[model samples]
Structure formats: C-alpha cells, structure tokens
Target: MQTEASPLVDKFQLTEDHDSVFPKGVPWVRYHGKYNDLSINIVCPGKDSSLGVDSVGTVSVSLLTYASVQALHPDIIINAGTAGGFKAKGACIGDVFLVSNVAFHDRRIPIPVFDLYGVGSRQAFYTPNLAKELNLKVGKLSTGDSLDMSPVDEAAILANDASVKDMEGAAVAYVADLLKVPAIFLKAVTDIIDGDKPTAEEFLQNLAAVCLALDQTVTQVVDFIVGKSFSEL
Candidate 1:
C-alpha cells in the first residue's frame, strides 16, 4: 500500500477556471493536501472558453498548463472543469465524466499534412483498477473553439463518438503529451448539446452544481491515486 511519501501523493497541478464560469460557493481550492501532501497547487488559465475559443484562449491554457507542469513537476496533472454533454449519447446535465480520450472537433484542416493534427487523440493516464472504484462515466471528450455547436458540428462530433464537448481538454492533453507527463481530466456536464435551451443558459443554470460535483469527483480521484500501491502508479 502507498504511504505518505508515495510519489503519487507528492504533488499535483490543476487547471481550468474563470470567475464568471465558476462563481462564489464553488470550492476551487478544496482538494489540496487533504491526504497528507504539503499542498495542492491550482492555476487558472484565463477567461472561460465560453467567452471565446480563439487561439488566445487555447494559448493561455496551454502556456499555463505547461508552466504549472514545469513548476510543480507533479506526479500527475489533472484538468478538472465543466463541459457540455451529448444527450443523444446519454450525457445528461449534472453528470461527471472521467475523460478517457480527447480530440479536437473544430480544427479541421483540408491539407493532408495537417489532418492528423486536426483530429489528434490523447489518452488520459489513470490506473484502470482504481477507475473501477469511481462512479463517474468515462468516454471520449471533444474540444472545440465554440460553446454552442451547429447541427453540422454536432454530426461530426457524434461521428467521432464523443460523448462530451469542452474547450480545453485537447489543449491540456496536448501539452501533457509533449512534456511526457501523466495527465487526467474530470469534467462535469453542465449542458446537453442540441438541447432546446441555449448553451449559455443551461451552462449558467448548472454551473454551481457542476462545480460542486467536480470538486467531489476530483477529491475521490486524488484519494485513489494516493492510496495506490507504488507498483500500481
């Protein structure tokens, strides 16, 4: 069994935040050192992806994530936040998901040379044995530069077999892959894609609840990570 000195519990880096997106009563800093670590560091990349999904947002998230990885050099990097789910695929509002794989949905490049980058896939690192202990759903999460998806976009996302949509999962995964660091994502569903309500409306309505659920889920994942045997990590 793991102990206080286990590498898995030695450090952690968290990201994804914005004041408007995560209002008061959200415990953004609740997971730190609850299990014997010195502390758990948190970083807010910038504005929420809802404001815009341009290069500015992506760059901010990537840079902050890269900086946090270098600074903490933690055993694991977790990107925890809220996302929109595809109700067609059973992603209902207020649900939490442990991202299994992530890809970009809005990065279509006609040129063959860049097609691979457009749809790049990255797998999250988590102990399969431990994952079985959590009650969260697991599936592909597609990242894009838009909060709302058009019908055409929804079709493409469904084709990719993505169950959830978010703005920063791919960017975070990409940075972790480049740095050769282990990473995982825990996201709560705040809206249902293609639902009758507008994306923003549903997102705001469920933001508080989603934040709380994410906090609880993140804490569980952390506890599981720290409790793992060294061999398992």
Candidate 2:
C-alpha cells in the first residue's frame, strides 16, 4: 500500500484521471513496497503509430513523455518493452537488453543540416555499473515508427551499430533528454530482424513468452533500484 506522503504516490496521485495518455488497456502502477522514497511511474503507449487518437509514434510518445514529466517530476524515467533483435549482432529471440544508447533508423533527412539530428545518438541514463549489476546486455537500440524492417534497412541499422530495434525507445529518450530528465530503456527481444518470417508475424508468435520474460526482468530492475542507496540512484 502507498501512503499519501510517499513521493511515488504523490507523483501518480492523479494518473487515474488521465488514462487516455497511456495505451488503451495498460494501466499505470505505483509501487511502494520496496522503494517508497523513489517516485516511479510505468506506462505503455499503444502499438499504433499513426496520427489517430490511439496512435503510437514519435508524436504520441513525445506527448506522453512530456505529460508524464509535468505530472510526475520523477527522478528517472524508464521505458521497458519489447524489441526486434538483429541476428547479425548475435541477438536472439527472448534475450533482454539494457539499452546503452538509442538513435533513429528511419529518419533520413535529405538536407545536410538536419541529417545529424535525424541520426543523433543519446546515451542511456543508467550507468554501466548498474547494467553489470543487473547482468543485462548493454547495447545500442534503433527506433522508428514502424515495426517492419526490410533487409536494406537492417543493413543500414547494423552500419549504425544498433543491436536492437523498437518503435518507441528513441522517442521516449529524446523527450526525456529535452526535459533534462534521466531515462533508461529495457527491451526484451520478441523477434529476429530479417528472419525467415516477417518481423510482425514473428513478434506475434513470441509476444506472450517475451512479455512474461520482460515481467520477470522488470521485477529484478525494480528490486535493484529499491536496494540502491539514494546517492547511488
């Protein structure tokens, strides 16, 4: 149970009223069991990326991130979800990664002045020591609005040194950066990029199992955060 005085409780006290900001069915949970002092909020923006009301994309994620910051003013923001791993990078289905950095793979600005921003890289908020402590793989993640990735796109992503691809990590990270809030991402591999089957098909096939794995992994992360000293956090 959470007390009214708890920072975590205070942060999310009004989240129930703004359910529209999050994924359609996923609800936000405020945990006070182990880390009552730390304010934490978890959200899952839906899978749709279009401009529709329930869409999921940079725009949607950016809005969610902004609203979350204004509402929570949290010490850290973490985006945990599923992603497609690249086989060429030794990634396999069911593997979980602690993203060290994130960038956009689909954003290709023709103009030279905007190219760097299109391909810009942002570091994860967690320290390398924390990743080692969690025993999770540290890798770069490429993000885009779409789940489907062609072979040519995979090649380009590999060239950029991204080991995993997700639909929302970079957008969340970018917003967190703009707000000067630390952010970290955790992704469980639900499919192999460029595999024999289509990425979407493979993801659907493995979604359930991957989601279970992600649940366990996220529990471990919460435990780690709760056990850490305030200075360490």
Candidate 3:
C-alpha cells in the first residue's frame, strides 16, 4: 500500500515515500514514463503541495490552463479521487476501482407537464479498452456535491453494478468530451456513507487516496503499460 511519490522519486529514483516497500537504494521504479503513450501531465486540484479545493470555476480554469500548457489532446484523461461508498459491498474500506461510468446522484428532472416525459438526463461514459485489460474492477460511479446519504441516493447508486460515488467525475467527463478526449475515472472507496457502520480508522486520508487503493491502481496501470510493450495493438 503506497501513496504516490513524485515522478522523479518514483520513476527516476530520486527518493521514496516513507512507507515504500523498496529496500533502500534498491530503487523500485514504479512509474515508467511510457504510460500507454499518454504523455500524461497530471494536474491535481492544487497550487503547490496542498490539495486546493479548486472547485467549480477554479477547476475549469486550472484544467483548461494545464491542458493548454501540456499541449495535451489526451487520448484519455482520468479524474481519480477518494469517495464515500454508498454500498461498499465486495469492497473494503480502501478498495480501488475503475469507474467506467459516472452519474449525478442528486439529479432529478421534474416534469412540469403531466403529458410531457421529463427528459431524465445523465451521461454515459467509457474508458478506452485499456481499462478492461488492466483487470481492475469496473462499475458505475455516481457523483454529487453533498455527500449523498439519502435513501434515494443509496437506491440510485445501487441501481447498477456500481462500487462507489464521488463529486468531480461528472465535471471531468464534461470537460474531456469537450476536448474530444475520453475522460476516465477511478475512486478509492473510502468510507461507507452509512452512519451506523464502524468508524473507519483514520486510516485513509480524507482527500488523498487510500493507501492500498492507490497501490492496486498503480499496479493495474503499470500492467496496462507493460503489456503494451509487446502487444502494441
């Protein structure tokens, strides 16, 4: 289980995370630059080392500016985050997931007219085939501003083969589609949204990923990249 280290530390052997399993000086380089040809430039919601909320307007401006700077017309852009699980079944407190689709958990289109079918709306999202080959668990990921704890919210997420829920996924999809790129997503299932569940050991960081979750995710992405070494299809 590991949180991410800087690319230089993780890739170029510059340093290591405190809990890194690697023997000192043995240099476990987990992040190889050739990430399915992503040429990825990650821009988390932040200014420096801190996780800036960068909500709404800030998120838009930052992403646009970063994308422009990287000259990245990405084939895939992923918005990975830690999320509270409405139903963390077949999941642990820190299970990592591949989110193939995300919905607005709080969305409801009211029908003003009795005769008119209120167009209930949500987005259908998919990762490139790469996600399937990564062998990570994939499912519907619902998003909303407030932590969705209502019975309706539980039912909405449970209405599918969903694993978890979050906030930023829908926005990421909107932006990536606008840029003509596939926006992918993942969530490290953090806490059960249920109030009665055993209090989680302040084990997982609030915004940063759950340790085991991030490790598994990185492993999957690494396998995806390594397989491309020969498959190149």
**Which digits, one per residue and each the tens of the lDDT, describe model 2 over residues 1-233?**
01111332333342433535334544322233223454456544433434323344577677777777886687777787789998878788988899988988888886986977987678988566667787888789998878787665666587669889987889988889999988878888999885787887898899877876776676667667875753474
TM-score of every candidate: 0.78, 0.79, 0.61
Better of 2 and 3 by TM-score: 2
* Positional deviation of residue 192's Cα in model 2 after best superposition, in angstroms: 0.5
Off by over 4 Å in 3: 1-38, 47-71, 86-88, 112-133, 159-161, 198-212, 226-233
> Which is the leading candidate under TM-score?
2
Deviation from native of the Cα of residue 11 in model 2, angstroms: 19
Which is superior by TM-score, 1 or 2?
Answer: 2
- Regions of model 2 farther than 4 Å from truth: 1-36, 46-54, 227-233
Model 1 C-alpha lDDT per residue in residues 1-233, reported as the tens digit of each score:
01111222234442323332333542222123334553465555433445532232455677767776775676678788788998877888878888888888887787996977887877888557656788678878888878888776676687668988988888999999999888888878999876889889988788777776777777677777774653474
Error of 2 at 201 (Å): 1.2
Q: How close to the true structure is residue 218 of candidate 1, measured as C-alpha lDDT?
A: 73
List, residue by residue over 1-233, the lDDT tens digit for candidate 3.
12333422244333323443333432222222344434544443323224432332224433543454345344455555666664545556676777766665555555565212221123444445655666666666766655535786666666544567776676566555556655556677777665355423432443354744564575466446543432341
- lDDT ranking from best candidate downward: 2, 1, 3
Alpha-carbon deviation at 136 in model 2, angstroms:
0.7
Alpha-carbon lDDT of model 2: 0.71
Q: What local lDDT score does residue 92 receive in model 3, on the 0 to 100 scale? A: 60
